[model samples]
Target chain A: MHLLAIDWIFLLEKLILIVIIISISLGVAMYSTWWERKVAAWIQDRIGPNRAGPLGLLQPLADGLKLFMKEEIFPASSNKILFLLGPCLAMLTAMMTSAVVPWASHLHIAGRDVPLQIADVNIGILYVFGVVSMGVYGVMIGGWASNNKFSLMAAVRGASQIISYELAMGLALIALVLHTGSLSLGVIVEQQAHQGYWNIVLQPLGFLIFFVCALAECNRTPFDLSEAESELNFGYHQEYSSMKLGFYLFAEYVNMFISSVIMATLYFGGYHIPFIHIADPNFAALAGFIFLFAKTAAFITVFMWIRWTVPRFRYDQLMNLGWKGLIPLALINLLITAVVILLHTQH
Target chain B: MNVTQILFWLLSALTVFSALVVITRKNPVYSVLWLIITFISISGHYILLNAQFLAVVNVIVYAGAIMVLFLFVIMLMNLNADAEPQKNKWLQFAGVIAGGCLALVIIAALKNVDAKARIAETGSDIGLIENLGKVLFTQYVLPFEISSVLFLSAMVGAVVIGKKN
Candidate 1:
């Protein structure tokens, strides 16, 4: 059988790794919700969920249980299949982005080298961009399927907002891509490690633009016009209930976690510790994993911090900032990078 | 069949099915969603052919950006309800006949082609981003630059059309 030509052991190893990474992502996303609330309370000078378990670490689990027990409501006038499909797509795209992220350097175990990523495809950054773009559909479909005027309006706002910011985000990323000259996330990280300077140092303006666009992309504060409560009354997910609603909310946190990881990977030198060196490959790999996790966690905290600190933008203001402010800035950054690279190469 | 062949067949079937659904769906929003599914299946085919960059770009451009715009316009028009006006019976009949004739012509044109001979293995590295970029810059530089100019003009045209007096 030609199928026998495939290495079963390697496939088994990858399957196990996939399972581990997925569960870890879910666990991190669960805790991020708890962390977000706690941070919000702290910023507001109030005690956060302390009753659940050790600083309310288990609060997310309780919340999950509550959501599950809540009654699922399908609006009589709503499109049933599309309504359900919305959150499912949101969750699916959220998880899909993780496939290209390299958690750590390869681990050498039992004389076999195991890479930490799922698929090290050549277009890793583009793959993430593609999946991130797909996330807009979840909001658009959910809002339109609700058969509510407000929801439809919010969905339209969301689709335009995402499209506007995505151009700036792409241009900002192009500057970084020029510096690294590779689309592979692993290669980008390695380049940063070898160069001993993260992309943020060279592309500070690009990073700022990218970070702002990331906030807008994730529908977080300052750019969260899609879900502006006072204006649109909870916006796109207004008709969602029970675990269906939970999935949408959970998907946001998951997207937050994944984007944080991407930001850390792209700008903060991924798994490369600043001044640490270990001779042993195994020890180095372990340290890289821990360092990458620490970086991701720090970024997640920043996301929550900004979410609590900033006010949501008005819809027109959001659109203006995305189109007028970020896009031109990103284009300028790209041009400057191109010129610098050309000069450097000539010299 | 081998795994690649099996995957190709599966993706082809999915793409065809979704394309049919895209045309047949009564609701325009549902038609747009099915169109997205068709694009995704086409991307799957690109991946099977080892063109990872093309696959991801296809999803990003077609299924993600363009389809979202399609859905956005559909929602803005409030066309989720069954509002499409049925075409005249004779016009519909003519449309079907024309479509069938086109299909027959395509099949006939390909009938004498050596399909097996053309099914040779593609260069694996040709689809990699590095090689693609090199070729684009060195060999196709003029066309690439001209395409950007075209996009710039299109953007300007859109702005002009969208501006309020």
Candidate 2:
């Protein structure tokens, strides 16, 4: 009976952690909008959103208010059920994938150690991959529901793009898996406890492939063909307005945040501070959790940086990279890694 | 029986029903819908087996990508419900008989094996992509490489069959 009580308490703690994570993600997404505009403005030598508050910090809040005030519009000919479902599904999957990520090591609360992650499923990496891949459905469904030819076309292109890059991403991940010999994110991070000798050193090619695929997967710039402004006029969610539009946009940023966390966890040796091992489990776990957030923030900034710097790839070129370039490169990387592991084992 | 057992029965029924609809349904859209249902129920079975990766992959590949392709092609071709050819009753009868015989054999084989709970009690680095890759490359190397070649050959065959003169 006591054991069951302890388990229930742990479960409650985990649920609270997840709720906190979700709120933090939403908050970051709101600020990200302000940061993006600021970054873009600075590049163009202009002050962005200065009217909202000091440094325009309140811009996100103002924007949220404006969205709330605006009338919700549904297209007359649209499929009402799926139209509503599209964004909700997108947001739900985006939120759910965050559960498996080990944000910190175990933390001692009231003398009982609590895991920072919501669910430390053994197949954490695959779960992340699966959820991220499902993200395409939201856009596809949204576009299809809009009952517009352009929307349908954008959705089709988006779905094809997502499916194509996933293969390359999976292949790149295979090389990393070969190196780490584990799929659990927590175990992978633990393996990379030492700083400077991260998996990035052994699998630079995999990191490159993974990062490029991340950009394509997130539908960010240089691969944001699905929503090229002049071409598609906001792409898949063009018809969306108000909070519905907000959901679509929010889901994208949340996905970006989660993928950045995944990348940090997977390749950047997540939550590991080099040569500085605080022996206390509590402090170490706290440090690791903070390190993860810090690393995730850095990746998010890099994502924004790349978005501003690079030009969008043409649709055909994007497809070519996925099918011809990245796919073949990934295969070669996997083959080489296998041979290396084989030779080492033989000796 | 407990909730898990009851849920298992429900999902198994759903899987069987969807599998039947996938083949027997005349409308291509309905076929795709049935396939998605089958995939979801299979994921339920994987949950029972404690294999999260397999469950997610079952949904991702079978429902997400494959069914999308099926739908895309059907829409592109404008396959209408009325245009679908009628199913031959004799073929249906033969299919049911074969399926029933296969199920019986499977059940009989399962009954002969000792039933034991083998739930993983320890947290071990197993069933991850890394282990799967190692096993595939080391022990199953020939089959792994051969399957890729087989896939390539099948792709070529498909292109040949699909080409418009």
Candidate 3:
């Protein structure tokens, strides 16, 4: 309402959230690489990056430093303007989407209660999806600008794959919206405050479709035709290296983290725990924040687990699942949900 | 003006600017990008409306999915500015005249509107979906039911167009 504004207090709060989310995303993206290596090693019965630091935990740090120290090379024939813009855009958009996610319930700082989110806009989910969608441009622009056939091809695949999967993903989310009857993610989580029951219980099909689309959207393997190393030799990022390449790589993890958090918020009842109720306005907000992060971490583990387990899909098969399978199923799910809601209201 | 009102004006200006860019940009790719900026700005407007549901749906459907498809098409076409046919002179003339008339009409309409209309202050707590549902099913039941049919027809239309060889 008229109460909403970019006032100093609100601006300060938003800035803090941005700073926190960006730092966490960067840190997680780095650690996730090590985590992926360790997880892969454990699965394959081999030692991971154990030499960098105890269990190679500092490996990401070492890798990051190497990227910074490496020479900055611009391809001779590339569109230099767009080339520079691509990775920056990629990293920026990935970091930007996390702004709306309800990270905590609420915080009571300086005797004033504030929501632990940057902006509790009515369309939190849509905003997340919008920002996430913008990410493809970074890949597409980067790939095209590289002027490398390999990069262009990879970008094409990335674009196509994202387009196909997103339909299914959006449809799946529609069913959830129908169930939760709200688009504000903060409100959605609040409805599930009693931890015992979550949207996953009622919308399992939606969850499955959502998770699959998330994997594809994040460009993880099995759906990562865009970056099939065996075929494309690093895909859209073929011409990228050093920090530019690091941006592309890190952005993927940041997206994975954000998507995982979104999934947790949607299905697992973000930051909601039962019996330990904090009805006090200030305390409830704080509790909500903790619940959100915990839920997000759990979903992140699931993302890692699936990445390790699944084999990359054939490009055609991936399209088929997205367009032919999931989309239609999601539509059917929405129909069924509508009918159920109608019947429930009647009763 | 208070911070929220100042912020709202900034966001609204950005939205309008991006929307204009969406239409005016010469590069197809840049046009798509501008449209995305428009989408994000509109989402900002939704947040302002406290209709968070509509805002998210707007992003998910328009910015997230549809815009991606538009980008994919533009990329597939691999269009360059020079590759595009130059605008016809008469068409440009007509467009300018029409645009001028449209701008004049908008300004005239705005002039007649009450400048100090009471700004409806809806709280953030009333979630969009529940309120939308109540309004949709009760006050707007007929229109809501009709819209479902319209959506169904649109779905059919999409399938028909997409399926054509």
Tens-digit per-residue lDDT, A245-312, candidate 2: 88988888988898898998898888888878788889999898888889998989888988888888
Please state the CAPRI-style docking class of candidate 3: acceptable
The docking category that best describes candidate 2 is acceptable
- Poorest 10 consecutive residues of model 2 chain A by lDDT? A1-10
* By TM-score: ranked, best first: 1, 2, 3
TM-score of each: 0.97, 0.85, 0.84
What would the per-residue lDDT of candidate 3 be over residues B48-156, giving only the tens digit for each residue?
7677777767876787678877877777787887899988999999999999999999998888777668555656644476677788889989998999999999999
Expressed as tens digits, the lDDT of each residue in A249-346 for candidate 3 is 89999988888888888998877776676768677776666676777777777677777888888878887888889889989998998899989999
The CA lDDT of each predicted structure is 0.90, 0.83, 0.82
Model 2 TM-score (2 dp): 0.85
The per-model DockQ list reads: 0.75, 0.35, 0.44
Better of 1 and 3 by lDDT: 1
What is the lDDT ranking, best to worst? 1, 2, 3
